[model samples]
Target chain A: MSEPIDRKTVESVARLARIDLPEDQIDDTASKLGDVLTYIGQLEQVELPDDVEPFFGAIESVNAIRPDQLTDSVDREQILSNAPDADGEFYQVPPVL
Target chain B: MDLSTLSAAELVKRLSSGELTAESCTESFLERIKDRDSSLNSFVSTAESAISAAQAIDERRSTGQAVGALAGLPVAVKDGICTAGIATTAGSRMLEKFVPAFDATMVKQLLSADAVVIGKTNMDEFAMGSSTENSFFGVTKNPWSDQHVPGGSSGGSAACVAADLAPVSIGSDTGGSIRQPAAFCGITGLKPTYGRVSRFGLIAFASSLDQIGPMARSAEDCGLVMNVISGHDSNDSTSAKNDVPDFTQTLNDSLKGLRIGICKEHFGEGLDSEIESAVNESVKVLESLGAETVEISLPHTPYAVATYYVIAPCEASSNLARFDGVRYTHRAATAKDLTEMYCQSRAEGFGEEVKKRIMLGTYALSSGYYDAYYLKASKVRRMIKHDYDSAFEKVDLILGPTTPTTAFKIGEHTQNALAMYLADIYTVSANLAGVPAISIPCGLTSAGMPVGLQLQARSFDEASLLRVAHQFQLQTDWHTRRPNA
Candidate 1:
């Protein structure tokens, strides 16, 4: 059996993820997260040989490079059309200050 | 004859003969969605432009112009795929109002093939859950039984095809999102080789495992769509540059001497008895068709769900971090500072499951715990792939249940996230190994829910996988069965 994740750890992780959790819901969320961690703890039982390499993706394919050339793919107006808050020329975001 | 009941292949034949116009075919599907979609909730939005596009196709045909392969067929796209000028929500509130100004490469290919775009179908939020219940839009009910869930994150795509809302649909699979729901909804869905289909416009969940494929009433129809969608794209770096074969060419090929491996691990405990018997009966059918079947052991199979939970969520955590209240995502209306706005926006925009996964991924990928969790899971993922590599050396393909059990009751797994994750046990390994796999309806349970038989093949060898599934579908009547609703 593994150690259950405490509320402090949950809070720390939520902070790292940039998500805010209410204090009242922290305990419940911690316990639920603990359950999932315990379930995943089974992976620790697999014996890995020293020579085994971790697999990140499927077979490696060589990158394709093309000659640099000027091209217009997407129109500037089309690109800005989906922005939630956009001025006539640029996206409008809150002031950095 | 009712146009809604016709298969994509049959519809294409009629359209080719000039007996039916594309406009009439698109209108029929749109009318069906209007009539039945309220109860099923399969479609998130219907496309008005689809009618105009179909009318153009009819005009082209009248002028004796050549039409593409999938002319006049109405196809539904999963909401996760971007469609130009259409709202492409990944079933999350974060993208609820976000519309892409450009079409996904697959959507462009579909239009080039002259297939009518029906609309966007609903799905799990950000392609996260096994049940469509996680969608911010609302849960999509199983067309077979309204009380049950349509398996997800591709649940809406599967349910739409089964209920005849659209003749065919496209969905992405990252750890069985497409195959599991297809099993539950009694339709055929394919998750091609990791890079067989381009991922240029698919919203990423796990980049290494995500693949977009076809979902339809038959494997033959999937092949028809595959011919149009499969090819290399310069936009997606991971997409394979392998030559695209005409998948429909082998649909009628004999399966004599095909070696099929029945993984002992897949049939073990927790599999429903009805599904087990149905799968066993399917093996017998394969044997009678002259294919050799052998019992093989994929010893590391049990660890697949555990490894997937770690790796997928970790990748998702990083992928979804882009939604910070900066450029185009949901922003908090009231915020004193940037950090507070980022925190509050993510907390409000993401659903419970998405947030839980983000938290879990954050913990796994965090410092001090990275080696013990993320690194360890990656090593185990290699072992899972090694097992499949060894099994494929002896057999041409692997066969098993698509899901351990059929579709469960809606809200059954909402509270228990681990239980929901376990539902993907039979399907995740294919994604982990970057192989091609498919789910086709094999049988129905005593309660009348559909069961799917899964088949997996070597990387980029989707031709063999589709051939076997097509032959089985030809001999069985399960694919022909429809819901009473």
Candidate 2:
């Protein structure tokens, strides 16, 4: 049986998603998730065929394919326009120290 | 005249034959956007460059240069896809300033095929929320109804297409982003088998689950765009090496003898009664078209949302780590240290929905809970896939409501995260199973909102799915209906 999702877990998820959620909303998310989980739990009761292979997120290739020939690309300014911070051609970041 | 209501294939022919000039078509759309975009808020950024490009294409065509498949056919892109010299905000404040110098692989493919790039459509920030309300820019209203949501994170693409602001648009789906919106907006959308299209320039959300696909007015148009962008790419190692098919070529194929599976699990409790009827009616239409309907059971369907919630956020958390203030996103006005800067930048850049997902994902992968949550979800995902494989053995395709309901009022599900996620209940399994799926308008809901029926097929079987959809489309005028302006 699947366990009930709780407020703590919801808060944890909120933090992971990087949204700042008020503590008040945590319980709501958990309870709602619990209901959804309950709905999904019904599937566990059903039997699956024996020959089925597990579904993976699409397929993966050993080596990424690319054209062998070199080609000139667009300038860096065009790529960096949306960057929050940039210095010349490269993205700018705080010093590691 | 509603220039936005024209189909891409039709527009392509008109432009090629000199019946319609690229400049005129571009101006018509620009005029439409000017007149209508304020109410729908579908576009984030319009491409002035595209107009010039269309003009240039016209010049080349006059000089005897061959016009490509999509020549002068305008298409919008979701905000998440990087466009050369265009803002690719991903609907988050984090990349609010970030722009890409190079085009994404899919964008390049469109350009090479002479597809006119129109503008960037809005979406849920980082494709996190199921409703466009999660966008930092504010919610995109459904064109069908001002009070309803367009669905997300590709809601902008769907809404814009539905409103006829653009002939077609490109969108990404990580758990039904494109399909759900297409369903909500009453248009056509395809989520090709994962890796069917290259992911080179798409910002990673759930890296494993994210895929770029076509959204358009009809199945044939989706196939046209799919043909140009579905090939494997070197930039994305996970892309399939399968031969790209001429999708439109098979659009008119007979649906005779096709086997479509109707999943009992999908229609169980939680589905809107109206949506169920719409889908059932569609299945009936397909049956009348000569395709056989078989009842199939994927008992594991229920577990998909649970499995998806765990997996998508976990992957999202990992992928989003690159956006630390020090790295790329918004930085605090004053941060005492690097760690604080990272936290604050993230806190400010991400919308509430995005943050919730990240936190859920991070906790799922955290030290003590990894096996219990992340690993368990992975296992469940595998089981879900297996169920699909088994079902496909008996049927050629699966039919269901792309969403459990029509587009809900914008604020209806925002207060309830679970309810919002449930909207994707009928659509997410395809992402987990890595199969191709399409959503086509079937009927209008009682509220006058468009209802979409989702059709899914086995991996690499897009031709079969499109053929059936096209056949159904030919018989019914659902796909041809445009929202009244």
Best by DockQ, which number?
1
iRMSD for every model = 1.9, 3.9
* Model 1 root-mean-square deviation: 1.3
lDDT of 2 by residue, B1-485 (tens): 45666788889888889888888898898788888899899999898897899898899899998878888888899999999878789998888876677899999999999888889999999998778998877789998889889999899999988888899899999999999999888899999998899999899999889999999989999988998999878778888889988988888777889898999998888788888888888988998988899999987787788788888988988898888875454787665655556766777778766766677677668778775666666677788887898999999999888888888887897667788888888888899888889999998877778888888898988888788888989989989887773
TM-score each candidate: 0.98, 0.92
Q: In lDDT terms, how accurate is model 1?
A: 0.92
Query: What is the Cα-based lDDT of residue A65 in candidate 2?
Result: 49
Which candidate gets the maximum TM-score versus the true structure? 1
lDDT of 1 by residue, B397-434 (tens): 99999999999999898878888898999999999999
